[model samples]
Target: MKYFMFLIFVLLFFDAKGQCCLHTDLSRKFDYKVIRLDHKDADGFARESKIIIELYKKSDKKLFQKIQFKTEGIGLSNVFSKCSDDRSYITGQNMKTEILDGDYGDIVIADFNFDGKEDFAIKYNIPADVGPEYCYFIQGDKGFKKDEYLSNQMLWFPWLINSKKHQLISIVSPNWGTRIYKFQYNVFSKKWRKIGNRFFRHDEGLDEELIRLKNI
Candidate 1:
């Protein structure tokens, strides 16, 4: 009886449902589901080092698709650019897809373009002192396409998505205190532009400002 019960429990666990999460934002909200995966490429490497994702409708989980391209891995600095001499950074294919840490990142599903259909963003939590790398994909009738406008940007660290105003928020520190920049997204041009700016000390709460902007 003990063995039989264990078998039944295992079956129920596997049969319950696949792991997935949904986005609950306002401006670019959609009813889509996300399945995040941290995979290791079997290229004779000892460590598991890659990220894969699946997106599908919440109502119909069976119909889902995987991300087409391999991630360029978590960056140490600006892997896209070399600041010392302003030269481009080139790396081998294997290094590009390796995982930086156990927590690969998250898969966010929403309508980033104000369209009714949903879009997806892979926020790679790079194992650096700075923020993570971002990759956005716009959904179409057939499948998703990489948004070059967003991909080319050197946005690092964590960022917040404001659905009501369609803005992306980030805090920057110069020689003085910290400055908050509210970047609004332009769907037609597929770019981000600063709309609001504020300065605060290290002790001030930046999140409070983010919440306050939703009303304006």
Candidate 2:
């Protein structure tokens, strides 16, 4: 009886860690197909997940490249709130057809390097007082290569790209600061440069009355 009990416990543990659901984004606007496998607990909270992306030739749907990676899981509430209209949850024998609409899923598709090709960023962590952390994958001649600079330097804050200025603009709430990173290429050195600038809240003319004298 003890041996049987031990076996059951082991099964339960594996089940909790291995339970996964499927989400896909086959949007025609994108050149590649994206599949997201979310590994969740019994309560449906994802702790770890996998992403599979397949690049295909538009002419005949021929597979060009396949890319896969694993990253930290996203909360169920976050997924539902962001992708409720575009994603369909699937598990086991029950399969729901994925709706191909706007850019959905955990991945953010954009041209981070300003190379005219769409690159992607996947959320890997959510630090306290900061925000979500992302792993950037830039498109290359061979395939998507992980970009350490963007992944490490840029925290996933409320951000946008300024195409005219060739800059990445992000707002960090904790420090109430705005960061701008200008992207430039050097022909002689054959390297890229990211020049960053920070504008603190005080620089933006914060009201002195808002701060208490005791706190200051």
Candidate 3:
């Protein structure tokens, strides 16, 4: 019985040691002031990770809002290196630039909907040739809500927002294709619309070379 108990204790100790966490202060970046990421160490990756986001009122420094979500895993080395440099898994620059450069990070902070409120995207899956998939959340009067349109259409590939044109652009890989979606308000229906999708392939300096692709 003593030996069995000792073995059990050892197992528990190793299990506890295998679990690690990374955190960052995002107060300057978004309303969610801080974020904590928890995961279990793998051979070369982290698995079963959870991201916890917290927001505080600036005036009192009191807790205002908290959100948590899960991810399958991410590259262990990448997460650790980024965390060591800044204690954050989030990249400091624009996500569009990183994606265009073929560098994918853990989180992206941006104003996704042109709502004047900041939004964010979390990398929740391993990246493919298209790029890392992200869970996009939009900020609202209540709180952040997962946006299906953005998550499905825009977050999968390297994308950018053009506030001046009210357009979102996505660049597809391998063939170097492009997709553009426009957002506009309709005076007749008294509703906002996300319409006018256009696609183009690598021009190759010739109009005939342009290939029209189906919507992704």
TM-score of each: 0.49, 0.55, 0.57
lDDT of 2 by residue, 1-216 (tens): 553354466445535443222123432323444445567778867766666666665455556677777765453424322332232111111114331211224456666666677666666665555455667777788777888766777656225465454556444445454333344444345345666554455435323322321132
Q: Backbone clashes in each candidate structure, one number apiece?
A: 3, 0, 0
Score candidate 3 by TM-score against the native.
0.57
Looking at candidate 1, the ten consecutive residues that score lowest on lDDT are 82-91
Best by TM-score, which number?
3
Q: Which residue pairs come into collision in candidate 1?
A: 27-163, 49-99, 131-157
Query: Which candidate order results from sorting by lDDT in descending order?
Result: 3, 2, 1
* Candidate 2 collision pairs: none
> Positional deviation of 214 in candidate 2, in angstroms?
37
Model 3 pairs whose backbones collide: none
Point out where model 3 deviates above 4 Å.
Answer: 1-46, 73-77, 84-104, 175-216
